[model samples]
Target: MPEHEAGGSLATPAHEVRDFLRRRREQIAQRWADEPLFRTVFTASRDEAVEAGKAVVDALARVADAQQVEDPDAAGFSAVREQLARMGAARSRAGLSNTQVSSELAALWPPAENLLVAESDQASPEELRAWSTTLSVLLGTLRLVAMQTALSETQSLIDRQRLQLLEVATPVIKLWDGIVAVPLIGTLDSARSQVVMETLLNAVVDQHARFAILDITGVPTVDSLVAQHLMKTVAAARLMGAECVVSGIRPAIAQTMVHLGLDLGTVKTRASLADALGHCLHELGTNIVNAAPDGAGRR
Candidate 1:
């Protein structure tokens, strides 16, 4: 087999990259520790960042040894994926876009290249260029992997936040001793509907309420899907030993329901939240009377 020689040593670009990474792991890590990607993330101490940088160097060495420097899915990357993800996420929290994070990663290249060049002082220009290219490709792949992981983590965070917002928006208010109400104000998708159902049912059991009201005046439109969700929520409340009332059915919404042939016959309906509360009060044997013009109580 033929051999590529650099400084009297037989070494291909891959072999040189592997050897360089192994021989100078400490130096590489120390230098990288000061980079924003590592420094900002491992804030407790400089040593922590240095250690994290060492892990990345080790992973790159493994990739070079395996001759898969260009492969993002190379097994070498598995060890440092979580670490890279954390770094990426931290940069994101610092208001760095993916492009900016990538640029920061690119900044790590010069220090490594300089070290490699110093060690290759006796090597020919062609050999040094080849080694530099190999290292650059490996580091570029690392950037790709980090960005991928960061995007995934960001999406997961967004999903969690959205669910939390839905829960917050669909708050179940205890309107009275034996009545609870959920005032919904937005588009009713399946996810929000599920949240509404779960929250309303929980409130029913917690409050021991006899009546539950779902006010949808703020909901602009109701499709068949929305109707189905509402029916399911009402049925669930009924099973939990509470009667559910649908309120705030505007004339336009009522017309829409009629046109769609959607039935709320099994569910009680009211024109407004005030009317629903009035019905609940009537069922609970409560009464309201007019007060005098003065600040006296009503009889």
Candidate 2:
């Protein structure tokens, strides 16, 4: 007999066990995809989903091995059993429903109780049937719990990716001449403002920029909170020995700034990037003439 076939005979029904586990994984994946809560709560990328599936399968294989082990002291059997128990406890704590557990078990061990009874060589029919039914129910519950955990983990990965996408999609430009321009294109909520601050800070440090420009022409309105965030950014830039120049202040935003009784007294403001550049040049005692109307040309 082939080594694999020989090994199979000494252990649990290996082919049947593997087939059952594969089916269970598929069922769980389908159910997770269909579930409203799961859909709303979790959304993983293709790679993440595949990796999570593999992890679930690997864990299930260990559990299957432990269940098939005849001797308590079989190599690595105790550890496998302990791991399964811990998994059970964790699932229970996670609050997976009993129905979910039963469905998962049905996938893992189709006609599971009957199979358990039929597989036992030593137990009498009555004893095997009883034990089989009880074990089958427990197994089903554990399977559901395990799948729920996998779902949670997959969802976490998706959330992280979503955050990364947000960061990547936001346009933050760093010029070669040590100027970082962050254009606020929409509403500035506290959360987004904080993200802006972090992005600017990291970019400034990474590029070793000596100047930062925050252009808010795209912003529709400004509240006191938004003004405060801008001030905070200015202060943070100062701390890093970088000057912050505010630009693109539309009349409406300017009016809102004044209405809020906010003081941008310490912040340097310019009508446009060109204006800011001119101011920078003037501060450095350089002259530019015959330039574009915005004074973009050399003297």
Candidate 3:
């Protein structure tokens, strides 16, 4: 062969080696592109892809070093073999073999490059699905909290109304044929007094009573407002064809009533419930027997 032809022949083999390396790299990349694991890694976060790519590079480097060493007994070859063994042990611990790692590495090469180029903030379907599930849980928790708050507020309002209603709706006892006794227990405000007046008037008409006993024995004190309310109640009882008997007048209450200048001309006065009952019997032409109480009907 001619000298130039010999050189050209030698260069042709080098060119072929370069071409072979290029073809092998391209083939490995394409094969990885078709793999499901490659696609998953590519679509994963950049940090994940980079980590997987590094594992693949370490594996390839170990295999390359083993192949490059010549004699197995030589120092370099022994060192390479030890490195390969250590890499193998690591791969085993990681739940993969050398062959499996190589295949995965080849498959993931393209995705690794893509991951490097892709934006970090771009979210994948898996990430979005996870986020949506988290958001749904949060919204459900918020709704539960809101419902609990509403229920608590409603219960509080109902409790307050119940207490107010109890103050106004407490039952009275009829001590005589014509006289009924109502014991005031708590603060007798104007609003509460109006309710009490209406209740007493209704009871008097229903029972056809000639007299009612307004007893304030349990009451601590009286205000001008309460005295005015009592006077109005007496007037209302008179309009309903019944008389009122004021009883259990404490010293403070008497002083307040006198100070307020409330006239009880239409109503009778008594010192106690028994006195009111006796007076009512005198007016009604009746007497108390060994009988059960009025409110103690067949319940």
lDDT of each: 0.90, 0.60, 0.54
In model 3, the runs with Cα more than 4 Å from the true position are 1-164, 167-169, 287-299
**Cand. 2 Cα-lDDT:** 0.60
Residue 69 CA displacement from its true place in model 3, Å: 69
Return the TM-score for each candidate structure. 0.76, 0.45, 0.43
lDDT of 2 by residue, 1-299 (tens): 11222122333344445445555565444443433333322345544444444454555455455554222233333333443343434444567564554354355443443444445666555544444443443344455454554556557779998678557634668754577788887777776778888888888898887788888877788888888889998899889988888898988778877888889989999988777766656654667665476564544
Which digits, one per residue and each the tens of the lDDT, describe model 1 over residues 1-299? 13333221334788788999999999999999988888899999999999999999999999888888878899999999999988887888899899999999999999999999999898888878888877888899999999888888989999999977896799889988999999999989999999999989988999999999999998999999999999999999999889999999999999999999999879999999999999999999998776666756743
Residue 132 shift from truth in candidate 1, angstroms: 3.1
Q: Which candidate gets the maximum lDDT versus the true structure?
A: 1
TM-score of 1: 0.76
Per-residue accuracy of model 3 over 1-299 as CA lDDT, tens digit each: 11222111233322322232233444434444455443453454544444443343333333223332112232322322333343334444567644564454343434423432242245554443332332232223222332333345557779999677766555667776666777777777777787788888888977777888888787777776776788888889988888888888877777777887766666678877778778888888886565566556644
> In candidate 3, residue 151 scores what lDDT?
45
Better of 1 and 3 by TM-score: 1
